[model samples]
Target: MEFENRDEYIIKKYQQDEETMIQLYVQWCSNHQIDPIALYQRAYPGQVQNESLLKAVEEKDQESIEISSDTLLEVLQMFGNDDLAFAVTEEIQKRSKR
Candidate 1:
């Protein structure tokens, strides 16, 4: 796809990266048997739904990828999703105690 300007290209690249991040999150949740939507809702209580998350769920393929807890947390934090990152941390802690 062609972008009109450098800014547009940057934005497009960020969006694509964000999508990858979301996919990674969803896959991580699946790998751990955690509900991604429920986790997202726990992070953002005000929003009933996350469109990108739902889309990722719908589009997820059979292939599975390794998503480390630390990597997922760092990626979420890097994307400015501190709340979600915290939620994931809490989840990790909860799972560790089990």
Candidate 2:
């Protein structure tokens, strides 16, 4: 799964797009059948990027989220290492209760 030098460069460049980030949010939510807002609230701990992404996805703003393959890759990252991610989220939630 190692990327070539060019591939890594492309991924970095691709990640620079806000649209790519938004699309990742959309795909991850769709794959899990959760609303993007709820998915962000549950999976990621902050409102900055995730909430913005959810808004972009749900609003269908047609800004460019759906057109980026790099975005799709980011969505996969949210779910792929999901065990650790979810575990951390749970702890955060638990701590919030105190």
Candidate 3:
């Protein structure tokens, strides 16, 4: 692969990784029969639509990926999405109590 600039290459790699993260999140939500968008809204009330998330959901492919709660939380935190991770944690706790 050839890149005109190192910055451009870095940015492209980051975007691709971010896309994979989003797709994983979406797949996790589907596995648990949860609405990813609604969960996101609860985490970020009054915020506008998350374009990346929406796009991920819309373009999601049917893949049977088993995502654990802990794994999802860690991934969200890795992406600096503490709010969303909190929401996911709450959901996990709620499910456990049921």
Candidate 4:
């Protein structure tokens, strides 16, 4: 409950809750009907998109996609969704044991 280093905690928490973060990203992509990897590429030109993520989106295979914790944070932050990003990070820490 007490994090001496909050940023470190957040990073570790994100890694632990990677599945939930990926699910949230998939839901967001589905709701917006936009491939998150593409969107990320557009947002940060010259940045390589994740091939697996692109393939998953192209194939409409949500279950096969795996999103990195950093990418999840970046995409969410890029879309101006600090609250959801924070929630996902916190949820990862909270639900890690389950």
Q: For residues 11-66, what per-residue lDDT tens digits would candidate 1 score against the true structure?
A: 99999999999999999999998899998999999986878899999998778888
Error in Å for residue 13 of model 1: 0.5
lDDT, each prediction:
0.93, 0.53, 0.88, 0.59
How far residue 80's Cα lies from its native spot in candidate 3, in Å, is 0.4
Residue 70, model 3, lDDT? 82
> Model 4: per-residue lDDT, tens digit, 1-98?
36768878988787556544445576555654445665545445565665545654565654544455567778777656576567556545655666
Deviation of model 2 at 88, angstroms: 12
Give the TM-scores of the predictions, in the order they appear: 0.92, 0.36, 0.89, 0.38
On lDDT, the stronger of 1 and 3 is: 1
Backbone clashes, candidate 3? 0
Q: How far off is residue 8 in model 3, in Å? A: 0.9
Model 1 is weakest, by summed lDDT over 10 consecutive residues, at 1-10
User: What is candidate 4's TM-score against the reference?
Assistant: 0.38
Provide the lowest-lDDT 10-residue window in model 4.
60-69
The better-scoring model by lDDT among 2 and 4 is: 4
Off by over 4 Å in 3: 1-4
Q: How many Å off is the CA of 24 in candidate 2?
A: 2.9
Ranking by TM-score: 1, 3, 4, 2
